[model samples]
Target: MTRKILHVDMDAFYASVEQRDNPDYKGRPVIVGGPPDSRGVVCAASYEARKFGVRSAMPCSQAARLCPSGIFVTPRFEAYRKVSSRIREIFLEYTDLVEMLSLDEAFLDVTENKKNIPYASQVAKEIREKIFEETRLTASAGVSINKFLAKVATDQNKPDGMTIVRPDQVEKFIESLDVGVFPGIGKVTLKKMHALGIRNGKDLKDKSLEMLDQSFGKSGRWFYAVCRGLDDRPVEPYRERKSLGAESTFPKDLENSEEILRELADIAEELERRLLKKPFPGKTITLKVKFSDFTQKTRSLTEDYTYIDKNELYRIGSKLLGEFLLGSGKSVFPIRLLGLSLSHPESSSKITTVNTEEEDDLFPSLF
Candidate 1:
């Protein structure tokens, strides 16, 4: 069946919430993260900040350099979560097939909506309006025949805008679509594709499956299909979150063992903060490392206890990194990325609701 899909994305959600709550922050570049002098990374950046080259996951120091007058605010996830719940309720009025990707975005299969809306774009428009009316926040939406198209369309006209990708326009649309704009293609891959003279969907489609396989390995088939506007991935409403993690790719490759360990320590620390906030309580702590050559290695250690301790996690992660560095037999130093994750959720720990302030107001800034 040609399903009707909608990708609804909140506009600079956390930063937007901060702006909404504090009118003074409204038109300014609001960045949600630690102070500028700290070694913390930016969690979110408003569109205003984007103009100054500030972006999420960028170091606060760099963001400060980019946008000197940017207002930095600590994240209030609980506040954002409340707003998200209100928006989700508005969505359920139209359809039950809602798949949330995060607190700020979701995929909605409105092929057979509860409201029985015939046109997907109308459903998208109504949903966006309802979200704004209820939460006092703007959301952008994309309506299309499939999930991939719908998702890409969501970014076309962003920050309270809607874009529809009709089935008839899919071919022409895909022809000029930039490979870099595709979700899964990272900076390195985009550079490689550019080197191969494959800049857009048409260029990508020109390659043989064998060529893609030789270049991207098993991911070649996926690239081949998506470049042709073909994606059969289904949006499952009850998709379980298997893990929670934090990772950072360095602007330049890190070669020193101390530098790699230092980055891993920071990643571990960030993971702990996220764990306390998300409360997944998984027993497994995993360390994932990527080399300068783009090869990846992962080491996992499962603890008997359900909850993770910050010290214990960093210890294990550092040890894991040390083991990889010694065992890989690479005399020279370059590690491209460092990641840490908590997985294999605790059997007894179902996600608890945050009703009262004492219950889940975990952020110090909120207090």
Candidate 2:
């Protein structure tokens, strides 16, 4: 059976919301994040800011250097969550099979929707119009027979646009798209493919399955399947988070231990803020670091203690780094990225005893 999926993505969501609420921010370079002087990173950037080469996850200091006059605003999650709920409500009115990808994006499986909208393109249009009318916000919608194509079509025309990939046109559409446009293909993957002389979907489609497998292993199989417009991923309404974490790539690598600690501390603070909302009372804290050479390493510690403070996280993370330095016998040169993650500890009930022994076994001291 053919499935009709509609992907709706808001343009520059966080920055856009800030602009919408404040009239003065409209049509201006607005960035959502911490102050530039504090070594913060840009969480989101408005389209106006994009003109100055500003982008999300780019260091706030670099963004300021790019656009000195850009306005900076801390994220307002509560406000954005309220807006997200309103949008989701609008989506549910058309289809019960709604899968939210993030706070500002979702996919609607309208094949079995109440409206019985025979044409997926019509459903996408109506949804966009209604969203604009009710929320005074512009949305881009992609209509396709499946999720992957629908997502691609939605991005074809951005900032209040819509695109449709009909059943008959799926093959041509997939063939014409750039390989980098496919989900899960990051900068590193793209670079590797470029070195292999693969530039676009057509080039990727030309490669043999064995060649892909030899290069990317299991992910190669997924790439081959998607190149033919085939994806079996379903749109489930329930939200299940597989992982929650935060990471930052610095504009330039830093070598000083002091600077690295300061940066890690900032990232830990952001993680705590996000975790507090979910009451992420997990016992495992993992530190992920990527060196200037692009070598990545992870060190996890499961504690008898639960923590959500920057100071505690920094202390543990610093210890892990120390251990790595001692083992590798190589000093950290320039730091590229730092990440922190937490996982739920095994437990039976609220009154259960803490498994101190199990915790020790889970995290062995590197020293």
Candidate 3:
């Protein structure tokens, strides 16, 4: 069976919407995030801002430093959600096999499309055109045989562009890619691969399956498969929210115990707000912290009761934080970031294994 997948990603969705609404924002650096002085990060940055090294998830203060004249716009999530819903409607006109990775990006199976377009490339182009015509925003699409290649292709030529990777091109394409381009290969994993002298796909493929398994443990098999252009994951129209989380990076490293708890209290409120939209009713509460030096750690607690109260979330999360910090309930080191999330549904506590769908570390969730 012919498998045709397309990954579509909006170009700076939040920033673009801001620019599109305001004429003066065009051709200027627009960073859609919190105030520069605030302890919030950039949610999305325009391509103009990106040229100055500004990017999503970067601290707003740093983004300001990078793009001195960057226009910082507070996120209008409701507006973005409306645009995202419109885009989803556009995708459904082509195929129902649409898997939304986030509000601004999705994976689409256009192998059997409503338009009956024989060439996947043409379908991708049509989708991009339709998105622009309707939303007044541009999109990028990558067309290939599987979700992996399709997602990667979407990033190749961005900002209203489309790329097609044919069957014959798949092998060469996979072999020529940098190891960092593969999904799940985060900065830590990429650094480890570099230390092991596996810089590119060719180098990674040279190692035997046994060697890879030894090196990467469970993820080794995934690496062993994708390096040779092999991925069979299908596009599902719906996906259950594995976890719902909200996190923030402080403008200054927090050292005071009171201050830390206050921040945790705020995060719990935000998480509570997000969860209320689509209640998870989870039994596990996890706390994530990033120290001043960028070292990260997580502590979780599974209680008998379900997660419903913000006060309880803060109570349990603070307890976990206290345990992690240790010694008189005070921190020896400064804390720069704090995150709270709920997972492990009441029915089951099993939450370890992560596929692509489960591995969004960037405040990434619909729930």
Candidate 4:
């Protein structure tokens, strides 16, 4: 029997929450992030803002430049998380095989769902309707026999779109797709593929296994499978976040040292909230920055201790930001994006295991 999977993604989740709570924000370009003066990046942009080319992870300052009249506000995760919880509650009503990809997205296995919906397309539609009725927010749903195709279907339509791919159509659909559209094909891979004259899925399908293996190592096998429209990965019920982070890009490149530090503080605060709730015992605190030309760099400091407190983590992040910003020799370009992440140490493996089991079993209803 063919399996069924559904991918549900909330449209403009953070910005939508802000618009929902504030009557004045309706129909306006709203950006949820820090102030432009603080070297802020766009955390999320409303559809109105998106019309002007503003996007999440873009610089808040640049977003304002795109739509000068847009309203820029800091993110309120407490409010957003409450909305996320409501959305998750809706997913559980259908299936026990619910896997949350993030607060705003998830995968549902309805092949044996409690609601007994036989057609996966019908299940997708119901999830979309329920999200709208309960949350007053729009969502996009994708229905297919596997995770890969389902995710692809979800993106086919945007701002509340639904797409369904039957089992038989999978191979044909993949054959016509662009290589860059495949998941895990990053900038580096795109460059390498271009050099090899492999432009799309059809080009990829022509490669021999030995050739692909030589180029991508173990990943070559996975790439070969994708070309044949084969994915056996299950709809994971729970995914413990390996890291929790918040990042923002600047509107204009930021050469200002003071502004960069301020944005880091804001990202640190958001990361802190996630850490406190999840109790990340990891020893690594990583800082990610992207330059104006999209060059990215990451710096990390690992400690022997796990941190649950917000203040201590913030201090360390601030210190790291200073170290990077106050370089003696080279002049730094304007900052485009800043990110902060906290990873627990390996020593906490036992605790992490316990937490994972508890989250999956004890709170199965929460998925």
Best by TM-score: 1
Ranking by TM-score: 1, 2, 3, 4
TM-score of 4: 0.69
Q: List the residue pairs that clash in candidate 1.
A: 255-333
Per-residue accuracy of model 1 over 47-117 as CA lDDT, tens digit each: 99999999776778899999999999998979988988888888889888899877888999999999888
Residues 199-260 of candidate 2: C-alpha lDDT, one tens digit per residue: 88878889999987656544677778878888878888996654445655555576766667
Q: Which stretches of candidate 1 lie over 4 Å from their true place?
A: 244-298, 302-342, 345-367
Per-prediction TM-score, please? Answer: 0.75, 0.74, 0.73, 0.69
Model 4, C-alpha of 149: deviation from truth (Å):
0.8
Model 3 regions lying over 4 Å from their true place: 244-367
Q: Report lDDT (CA) for all predictions.
A: 0.76, 0.74, 0.78, 0.72
lDDT of 3 by residue, 182-201 (tens): 86564445666888899888
Per residue, candidate 4 scores C-alpha lDDT tens digits across 1-367 of 7899898988888889889889899999998877976565677889998999997656667887888989998888788889999988989999988988767888889999888877888888888899899889999988998888888778778889998888788877887887777765643456668788888888999999988765654467778887887888888786676666555544446777777776666666556544433344567776666666656556566676775344566677666666446464222766666666766554432221110111111111101
Lowest lDDT sum, 10 consecutive residues, model 1, at 358-367
> In each prediction, how many residue pairs overlap at the backbone (N, C-alpha, C within less than 3 A)?
1, 0, 0, 14
Ranking by lDDT: 3, 1, 2, 4
What is the C-alpha local distance difference test score of candidate 3? 0.78
Among residues 3 or more apart in sequence or in different chains, the pairs in candidate 2 whose N, CA or C atoms overlap within 3 Å are none
> Candidate 4 regions off by >4 Å?
243-300, 303-342, 346-367
